[model samples]
Target: MKTYTDTGKKDTRSGFGAGLTALGQTNPDVVALCADLTGSLKMDEFKANHPERFFQVGIAEANMMGLAAGMTIGGKIPFTGTFANFSTGRVYDQIRQSIAYSHKNVKICASHAGLTLGEDGATHQILEDIGLMKMLPGMTVINTCDFNQTKAATMAIAQHHGPVYLRFGRPKVPNFTPEDQNFEIGKAVQLQEGSDVTIVATGHLVWEALEAAKALNEESISAEVINIHTIKPLDTDAIVKSVKKTGCIVTAEEHNFLGGLGESVARELALHHPTPQEFVATNDTFGESGTPAQLMDKYGLNAAAIAAKAKKVMGRK
Candidate 1:
């Protein structure tokens, strides 16, 4: 298995902020709108440097979405920043009508996604955001793994013309991916090549999946690890190719299995080549108050959980 070293521990939201800051410098047409959580989302730098282009929409998330969509009509690439729940669940109607349906160049950058949001509990931890956004036509859903990937995805989405849902987290995680890597939409990154079982992951689970691969390797099992950053326009070809070699898969994500990455992979595999698949995700349950690590472990979303699932899925094959 290929080894990965953490450059440092950083929150993915900071990555989004860094990317937006860079866009503020280069892309004059790029504008940002935040719904009362500028510091939380790490968008203060963009607001500071590009005061004229930054829209403080206050706590009205729905209004923020409407404003972003309207700004796109005037050829402005608007990136709306807010919590995952408020970004999608609270403003679905506006997004569906003004953004996705019309194919507006609006980027819905969501922070504090999934169980990693922690302490603030289920109300803040929006596990269903991925499913909600992915269901919208013309909306590109991207759940980046770490700081570097999140920054890359943020910068890449600014260039893409269409509605996009970019999901990131609050808690600091291992920032392993290269700082200067090209961010390709709908393209899966193969972290390790193996023939025993394919382990596909996204968001915070990507690092966990790598840890699982290492554990499996020590056990003499060759597990393929693929980083799936884009959930909506999934890299079906990579998934199919990996599964064809391994004959089974283990999908790990921080969201629920009901409508998250696992479901998407399962659908793709069933249509192309049916195979035994296991999921390392929340079992259709809500998150509670705890630290990020505690929630991940309690909900069975840690590296050990992923490794256990990989072993079980391999046995079924």
Candidate 2:
């Protein structure tokens, strides 16, 4: 079994802010817009440094999407920042018609996603954002794992042309990945190799999956861990290849199981390979106000839940 060390703990939103700041320096055409959450989204630095390029759209998320879409026509890559609920649910119509339908080169960067948006309650968590965005025609959905990966993804999306939904969270997580990682969209990073079971995870759950793998190793259960950063344009080949070797799989994510990474993986397996699978995700339910740790434990979205699911799925193999 391979071991990973946490360099530090940092919020993924800060990584987004850092990436935006870097883009402001490197990409001349890059512009940012926020819907009354410049600081909450960690986009304060970019807004401050590039005031001319930053548009404070107040709380008008729909108008912000339209403005971003229009800016893209002028060859400017606009990165819109706000809470996940507002970024998707509140402005879906604007995004669907203006961005997705037209295939605008807009980056819809969303912060405070999933149950990790502690004390915000279900209305703000936006667990169904992934499913909503992925169902769009040309929308590329990305759910980054850690600070380093989030930063790398934020920078990488600027080079890609098309509408993108970049999702991150509020709570600080273990920063385990390399600082200089080459984040490739639609590419799955296999952290550990095992023949017994494969664990595919995304977002904050990626760290939990790693911890689960470590615990499984202690019980003599070999588990393969794969970090799935990009949800849409998913690395289907990587998932299929791993499951073929293991004959069973476990998927973990911070979103709901109904319309999340687990469902996507399940669909791929049903078509290419039929394998036993277990899901560690919110069971088609809304979240309540609580501490991040409490919410994660109550909803079974942590290492213990993942490990137990891995063991259960392996039994079916």
| Candidate closest to the true structure, highest lDDT | 2
Model 1 lDDT, full chain set: 0.94
Candidate 1 lDDT, 23-46, residue by residue in tens:
999999999999999999999999
- Where in model 1 is the C-alpha error above 4 Å? none
In order, candidate lDDTs are 0.94, 0.95
Cα lDDT tens digits, model 2, 27-57, are 9899999999888998888988889999999
State TM-scores per candidate. Answer: 0.99, 0.99
RMSD of each: 0.6, 0.6
Q: Give candidate 1's TM-score.
A: 0.99
